[model samples]
Target: MAVKVSSQKDTYKATAVFLVLMGVLYLLDKWIDFSDYNLDWVMQKDTMLLYAAVTFLWFKSDKSVGLILAGIWLIQNIALVTALLGQVSTYLLPLTLLLIGVLLYWLSSK
Candidate 1:
């Protein structure tokens, strides 16, 4: 027997997997000093929550929304990288993720 696949199902799976990976990375960053020894525990928790929400929304929703969320995650990761590289120590990742979530929601609605 062959397994049938749906785009929505696939998207949901991808989003779920990505969220898990991100969460792991966040955890690693906590003790591993990946972010310039600057670990914002609260922000990490919030990002995890956002990823959870996106994973939940991946089902039966517009693909663009997920893409946007991913895009935002990409940006946050970049910012975290920047911070870790000793660039700056500002609270920017959470705001960027929030904007990404809202923008993705808007896009999905359109």
Candidate 2:
């Protein structure tokens, strides 16, 4: 009898771990905001970071997640446009950060 096994590439495993960690962080931040709306600043910052982490995690192996990020990228762009239209506030630091994250993710996937 012989034993056979399969192993994932280190990059894939690393990306999965990164994605899980980022997802968890985002989930935690979301939970934290449920009780207090005053933490908007901090939540937004963390959310951007979370998006970055998630992007890095799904960089190569997961096209679905990448698509999701693409959607977010579009949404963020629309937010900026809406701000220009006077529909949203001009203080878009967080969305800008998240846009950077989206760009980074796109780069990593390439």
lDDT of each: 0.62, 0.58
Q: If scored against the real structure, what TM-score would every candidate get?
A: 0.32, 0.30
- How does candidate 1 score on lDDT? 0.62
User: Among all windows of ten consecutive residues in candidate 2, which has the lowest summed lDDT?
Assistant: 1-10
Q: What RMSD, rounded to one decimal, does every model reach?
A: 9.2, 10.1
TM accuracy, model 2: 0.30
Tens digits of per-residue lDDT, candidate 1, 20-46, equal 778778677666755575555534654
Q: Give lDDT tens digits, candidate 2, residues 19-103.
A: 6765786697777763375656444643554455455445545455555665565565665556675733455655775897899
